[model samples]
Target: MTISSPSSPQEYIKHHLHSLQFGEGFWAFNLDSLFFSILLGVIFLSIFHRVAHKATTGVPGKLQCAVEMIIEFVDKTVKDMFSGQNKLIAPLALTIFVWVFLMNLMDLLPIDFLPYISQQLGLPYLRVVPTADVSITMSMAIGVFLLIIIYTFKYKGVKGFIKDYTLHPFNHWAFAPINLLLETVSLLSKPISLGLRLFGNMYAGELIFILIAALIPWWSQWVLSLPWAIFHILIITLQAFIFMVLTIVYLSMASETEDH
Candidate 1:
């Protein structure tokens, strides 16, 4: 759908960028991000739930077969990357891949579709792509970070965890201070990188779509958008896969026995 005549391209971009937020400053919340994230999650799970219940051995439906394939792919990915045999990792990988994929898939929707519908419904702004929001991306990264911490303690105990941080790569007593700083930064950068990587890719992709819609004539918008959307399909899927793989790798590092 075409957005009728914004006063300028900047105004058009600003309108699309504005989120449905409430409260003040640090306490503010993005209602549209939360709504779409939860909505997409529910939709993803509901479809999977139906597939699970309706699965059959004889001539499975397309949806059921596709889900089974995804389950198998995720299971294989987890088994390959996750060193320890935790049943949770497979399901977690599956959930993360599918959910994040669906979330990123939101970028495929027409740029103005949700916002236009929401405008008519009294909400001023709506960004359909949840991953474009830093908070959502960081929260997912933090959740994985928590799992990494938990598995580290579960496998290595508190003392071993501390020792892993303090003693490695600098065994000399005089080097302990330097080791701690380096280790602390190293440990912290994982989640930071994960969050920023996904956020940057998605935010840029969404912005490009908005810019296309804003700068191009309504009649000519499809010429740019269609190609970008086609390319973005690969990007959306890659980001999800990368997130899943990194989570598996990080958790594997946490749960595995340290090299002597």
Candidate 2:
């Protein structure tokens, strides 16, 4: 019987980055991303539900206090950016912040641990961070894009949305073409920015972790990897917060009646 050598660092990283698929060609589904993101969502929702079920008026528990702090922070942000309309906006913003933060936090796990375990269980691939996948990020951005369109029509009406796209900032018939072109470009830029910002940050962070894990001399790997991972806690949190805030801001802009 012949035994195979352990995979090289590059091979290991590449294998881990691959996704579990459900089909071939254009119909393939990224099962790994869907599974992990849904699992994380369930966990987050469970925790929030537990905290809500045990609410207190006199004294707050640690979990309640933490939840309240996050709620207040999200509420304040929405209030400042979104005005007092849109009853659903604040809760949605809060959920996005917490959920994305938790998803990004998955990067903190040991790079090879999940893949190794999955391999043992005969699973071919698993990419844990959904945000690190371009498809996932683009899907999220598209959802935001749809929400923006929906809110635009809801708050401003179909005519208002069209007017804003074709006539805002320049209300003359002669400049209609220019106004329409510029506004269309600006509107399209929102989803592109949303998708790229998240994909870039999470992808870069994952790449760095892979590179660091590839280093030899086990002692040196520990010495450097630990500090980098520690600092990455802040990076992941900030990226998630930025994504959430921008989603709220874009939605707010869509809901606004003014063009400026």
Candidate 3:
């Protein structure tokens, strides 16, 4: 996690973008992203666990009320979008929303705050927003992709799943190969596009924050950064909601039967 002081703005941007890494190539790991992602996940689970444990029927505390509202909102969204009767959808949506929102929320922090703290503690490369890292977002997207596969197979069966790609959209043996090609690309693009979308948006947002900090004098940064930060709150929340809604929609489509 050690980094040399940057001599130029390009070097500064490059340094800030670099991850605390280990290993090489495909085996390399971004330890900072992993650390903060897991940390935020644990925080989300711990708070929800505590709130649920003490939840009361009447006069709920502010924390409990907020948690309930979030749960209800996610539940309603699941009911609206997810037609299948899988109990996992609601919880999965809630987890994705909260976990991703928490990760994106890190971008609102002063770009250098955590990294500076880490540097003082003898670690220099620390990127706090896990969503800004493609690997993290892709991992999550792949998880959803796997769930889509599982649900498709669970509801449609192996033969049906194969036929899904190989048969219709043309419904003839002549078009099976063509159908498979189009369907496979379409299915595969779900995870690829999902992962890249979040990564692109958050990465851009993080870079802008870094740019403001690097280019502006500390005394005047508030003039521009404040407005951007306020607007960014909407971006972060919208990204989280989009991710959650898409996950639900994909799973719903996967869980559909021929009867539907």
Best model per TM-score: 3
Which prediction has more favorable lDDT, 1 or 3? Answer: 3
Local accuracy by lDDT, each model = 0.90, 0.84, 0.92
lDDT measured at residue 120 in model 3 versus the true structure, 0 to 100: 78
lDDT for predicted candidate 2 compared with the true structure: 0.84
Q: Can you give the lDDT of residue 225 in candidate 1?
A: 90
| Tens-place lDDT digits, model 3, residues 187-206 | 99999988999999999999
| Worst-scoring 10-residue span by lDDT in model 2 | 1-10
In the predicted model 3, the residue pairs found to clash are none
Clashing pairs in 2: none
Give per-residue CA lDDT, model 1, range 167-253, as digits (tens): 877876678788788888988999999989999999999999999988889999999999999999999999999999998999999
For candidate 2, write residues 22-59 as lDDT tens digits: 88887889998888888988999999999999989979
RMSD values for the candidates in order, in angstroms, are 2.5, 2.4, 1.2
When 2 and 3 are scored with TM-score, the better candidate is 3
